[model samples]
Target: MSYQALYRAWRPQKFDDLVGQELVTKTLKNALMTKQTSHAYLFTGPRGTGKTSAAKIFSKAINCHFQKDGEPCNECDTCTSITAGRQNDVIEIDAASNNGVEEIRDIRDKVKYAPTECDYKIYIIDEVHMLSTGAFNALLKTLEEPPENVVFILATTEPHKIPATIISRTQRFDFRRIQPDTILQRMQYIVSQKQLKCEPAALKLIAKAAEGGMRDALSILDQVISFGNDEVTLDNALMVTGSVQNDELLQYLEQVTQKDTAKALEILHQILNDGKDAARFIEDLISFCRDLLLYQQMPEKVENDELNVVNDDFRNFSQKIKPEEIYQMIDLLNEQQENMRFTSHASIYLEVLTVKLATRQTTISPKTPQAAGEKLDPKDTIKVENLTRQVKQLQQQVEQLLQNQSNGQSVTATNSSRPKTTSYNKTQVRKTTAPAKVDLQQVYGVLSDATRTSLNELREIWDDLLNMLTVAQRAVMHVSSPVAASPDGVIVTFQFDFLCQRAQTDQPLKDTLENGLDRLIGHVPRLIFMPQEQWPQIRQEYLNGQKAQKHLTAGEDGQRTEQETPGDPKQPAPKDPVVDTALKLFGNEVVDIKND
Candidate 1:
């Protein structure tokens, strides 16, 4: 074979050689030394975090002829073959490629045969999450209880995709992303062992860029070395990684958070012109903001470069910017990042994002919590004010009448002591029989801007809404069906007129219904009820009224675009139907309704 890649050549061959997985190594070594190993094991984590390497080492350690205290003697024939991937017993399978039921069945059938080259037959399946659902089902029985002396080791980056049944049957070991410092030390050792000249800053950059994956760090390092003709430098590392200098990223952030839009956009233009990825720049900015926020809160955590974003400039910038401002910038950046994913012109998004962040207001004054958080509809406000004013006027009139009676003490009071009936000509009182009529204003209010989606949203919560009420309240609601809904109100047609009248008059039912709906959907509705038989006529009348209103608007404007669009904008939406009704009722009607 040709020369192996750095990641391949530096693959951990022994449990002790594994980096940054002390707990995993310790447990595996204990199990092997005590001759107590699981029939199946799962190794899962981010890519290049020593999952497959750990699995391979475990396989060799378990089957090595010269195994000593769970350590594989690489000199032994069995261990050497496994290391070379030529061992018959240590079977490595790429589940991503051969993930089928038949392939798994073949393995199941072959497991019965004895090991030819080693004491135990070990199966290592890499990227095992790619196995089909049927393939996972096929391997379940064999995985849970394979033939004696057979072991299965499954490795994957995405453990969430794996079936719980598969994970439950195996002893799971979670591999963490290798820390940057740990990777830095490992890279330093690799460079020294190879006797190559490399910059400390370059190694640190590669380590941070690896993002907790040692294999990724090494691969980046390999590319940087190749680019620098076997000599690593910071410039080569930066070119390979496409990361802006720390000072430059810091400067860009400072300009943005300080509300310097032009300067920030200029910096972004230059950075993008240098071939830096827009998406990558977004991610880098988000990460930088994260570090800045963290450093601002915990300045002591910067020891040993623990945060991996520390420099004199970063620290000073962190001091200059408020943590909460960083929070807003990060939020804006993240939103733009999601938007960037759907578009090819990422530079446009980046520019827009820069301007938004730069101009974003940082000093947000906290809102004083209101006793009632929501504002009333304009119609509701007018009704309340009119009612209040009328009440004050009535109180003053009543006081005047009382004062006049007290001062006069007239003969009417003396005459009221005797019981008397006044017989006036043409004075007759008789009760008239009339059924309760559907309130047109109420139905029209709900159907004003009603939509199918709003009706569906109301109906979807009907059962839950009923469940929230008392037995009597539920009984009143059970006879009701939501026929139409706008954002602020719903028209519920009742099975009976009595129930409809009861729903309107019952104060308790009103509160629970509206309040429960508000709790469920975060908005209260002006619930209207009418007998079910009257709903069709009312809906037809409302639609006709809408058409008439549209016709009137067209006559006044000399244009009708209803054919082009099914519904014309001439029919103003019920921004707040209750408010409009109040305004109309209170003798103050605007000829044109502003679409606010």
Candidate 2:
């Protein structure tokens, strides 16, 4: 006999042998015992969860002549032939390959014939969802009115794609993913039966890596056994699964908590150099952080779950990190994991993520006394205490000054000639409240040439413009409106000063708005940001300055009129250009000349 894989050699031949599907096995066994089995059955679940195996077992049990306790007697000739795949009455079809109308039609035609050597003819169609529309239409009629002693078992990972008509006619059983504990127990049984030496921890790790799939667990176990020397250890399991050791993962996490970028990168590089997968490392790290968080919240639960053990080092490390920081780390690691899926440069992203984790600032309050004592030097502690004392003394002095003023007494110096200090004194804590700088000149220039028509056009489609921006950009511009507009630029005023400043400095946001406007309007005008409170004042200041300048100019013109002669032909017209242009364009009486 050729070498057989573990999954193939250990295929369950009876319903009772199936793992992690008690509900399904029990139901099927009861149905078989009562002789009330349905003609068409649909088994749907995730891959490697015993859907097909259960179907095969049920087929054998229903056909076996010497069935005991609703289980097929493997000793019988009928069960033997079916187990060996030599029975003509029981057929297994791969719907993925034969998903055509002709194949379904062939089944429809063959289903009418009576069983040649068995009591019933069973057809197991795996991946039935892969069938074409025409194939489903062809199978629907036969499934609805199958011949007596004929059974159809449809197995698929995705049941949603199956036609409702076909699903309505069949009895559906939904299977669930096997739990890790159940998988571990089964692995232990298999290892013990095969006389293989394996560590308990190794089995547990395999169970976790299986991710609720029995076949996958068995496959991983087979690979590990083949690689090891008759004895499987935790190291061998980790190596096969491309996972890091617990101690190494803890050390890497310690580096992150300590904010040691260099050491964390070195550890990451070593892991990658040793052929560990970057994605797996990230996944393990994320799991480790989650465990730490859970331990922090519920230590008793963590202690109970053998899979989530909290060692002395892990518990100690949990105290050093805060729950909030751990939450942030998990979120960031999850983002990196998402990014790793679409890019081949996973190592680069891993390195960058490592640095981010190492350098991430924690918002936790002051460190614990033990932590502070460990990191702070004695001399630095002394310096901090002295500075605190000096601050207290300064505060006391200010309070005393206020008390003296409230009591209507001046703080007089010891010497009579010296000056008295009072709270109202200008030299006492002078606060320079400088207003935020605004370029009134530029604002005035824009306002002077502002075009109302252009402003109205932009305002009409302002909502549309906002729609073109990203969600974040729209949020930032929500409190803003276009107050002034021109052919060259537009002035947008914000209700809050901070938003005005943000809009002024956010170049990318400005660029996005400009691009959006360019698409909406024919031209992209420059955006000018100003606070609503400051806009009116700046405009008024500009107008008042203009008026003052005009008044001064008119006064100078009046003074010049008194000095200039009416018709002075011999005075060289005072040699003034303004006086000469005034005499040339208008008559001397109507012209007002200014002279220096």
Candidate 3:
């Protein structure tokens, strides 16, 4: 019974009384002064930003018997009657409650009559967006072409909801939220007028809690005043509003900075135990982090109680955190806040959030680096090793299959249609069945030729490698040498340096090389790949053969030596008739023979 909400008591009564909305006030005053006031005027803005107050004052100003300049005389009988809500000519209706077609039709009927005492009949409607479609249609005619003596003043927080047709017939004014300084000044004036005992810090806490809505700030003040009689303090204000004090927030931040999960969770649990809303706590944390971000970015703009919310200790803590990190923290807390709505276990959420934030933040103290390092176990190394082994195995399997496919051999499969006996000469069979069986060098040659033109072309044949081999076997394959087209077949080389690196002898690689070359060329190819370290020796042997004219080019030997051994390093090295013929047809530039 003793309660009087501060917002209602502090409602603005004059144009100058409006806060943080100079544009709206100036425009309305100009309109009133020029006698160019529209019959229907629409006011739109966020809640508690003087939209309704301005509408009411404008209505009174237009019909005041003792108007001065562009404002109403508050002492006049007409102004008094309007303010008291006793004037029939000045009507104030809540569209939220009276948003039916019948209500609008009733107003339409009443608009036909003229004002008896006041110069104009003023109708002020609040929350005009709540009107139903039919009700809006009913009001349309009167709004577009109202009676000469009547004026319709509509106010809405959401102008988008109102039909464009209604908006077009009216003059629209948008209101903005009150600034922090404006709210602070207004609050100070209210405290002085009521003779209330309050700290300036308490006023700032209330202003920040309101988030730019004057109504919310006033309501908070009203609640705080009630909690502590007529005297309001910071503690009492925070208590009533469930806003955790800055000191408590800083303590939580310190625990996190120290990576003290246990302490952090305990503190969070205590907050929950104290019956504070978990979502609201998360929201306040977001706001606290936002202020830290602003402090880091624009320290000069932050002042008043917003400055006191963060102390030197908190400033140091903020300095340790980057703006991006604080923003990420806010984002995470906001997500948790939304999730908490559906979760019955809000405490669990808060605890998890506390651990997450605390665990991720780097400590300000240099002494805790080792402890932080130990906190995250190096498990990724094991995963990386396993993945590398798997990839190697996969590459080996790709090579083996490619070899089998090139050989025209139906790779070891369970199908009954597979040949029971393979066709080959005794030496070829011996080479295939030998202990050092898989010819890796020949497989490399086949793959090299296959991939010579493009990588995409080779990828098509890569999958066929799987179909050509036994399930237990895999071969690490690669194109070791460039391709050269010859009348007999395409020549290639496969690098098997990995085999030597693994300490495996080159016999198996040679066998794989032979089989793969025979399949790719339609006939067995002369393949060459051995230990990389032995490559210089092999090249010397070839040079010795070419110089001596052995096994090939016996007729053209002397003639070829002069032309083949060009001084330019870029020219292809001279080789046997097989290589020379292949290079000539394939284009000499197309071939590259890497010794290793």
| Candidate 1 Cα RMSD after full superposition onto the native fold (Å) | 21.5
Return whichever of 1 and 2 wins on TM-score: 1
The window of 10 residues in a row where model 3 has the poorest summed lDDT is 484-493
**Model 2: what TM-score?**
0.60
Which structure among the candidates has the greatest lDDT? 2
Candidate 3 ranges with C-alpha deviation above 4 Å: 1-3, 303-309, 342-345, 360-596
Compose the digit string of candidate 3's lDDT tens values, residues 1-596.
58557887778778988888999888888888899888999999888888878877887899886778788888888888878779888889999999998999999998999898899998999999999866876777689899888899899998978866678889998888887768888999999999999988888878877877888888888888888988989888767777777677878977876789999888888877776777668878887787788778877665444425556876787788776567667777877888898888888898889988887743343555466665534686688787998788667655655676567554453345433334334346545542322354453334334322433333344445433333322344443443332232333324444533332344344443434333333333344334444444433444455445544455455443334435778876655554553343344566875441
Give the Cα lDDT of each candidate. 0.80, 0.82, 0.70
- Report the poorest 10 consecutive residues by lDDT, candidate 2: 426-435
Using lDDT as the measure, name the better of candidate 1 and candidate 3: 1
lDDT of prediction 1: 0.80
Tell me the tens digit of each residue's lDDT in model 1 across 1-596: 79778998888888877999999999999999998999999999999889988888888888876788788988888878888889888889999999998999899999999999788999999999999866876787789889888999999989988866688889999999888889999999999999999889889888888999988998998898889999999988878888777777888988887789999999999998887777778777887787777777786776456437576777777777776787788889889988988898988998898889887877765663365486768998899898998788666655654565556532222234333333222112111323356678867776666666777788898999899787878887887888778888888888777778787788657756765675578767787777897878876676667656766777799775344433666874434343443333222433454433
lDDT by residue for model 2 over 1-596, one digit each (tens)?
99889899988888878999999999999999999999999999998999999988888899888898899998788888988899999999999999998999899988999999999999999999999866876786689889989999999999988866578889999999999999999989999999999999898888888888999999999999988976779888988998887789999988988889999999999999988888889878887888888888898888897775568998899888888888889989999999999999999999999999998877766777687676677998999999998788667667777777677666654445434554454333233423335666566666656656777788998999888676787877889898777677778888877677777777667756765675578667767788788777765565567556655776888754334655766655445433342343233665665544
Cα deviation at 478, candidate 3, in Å, is 62
Candidate ranking under TM-score, highest first, comes to 1, 2, 3
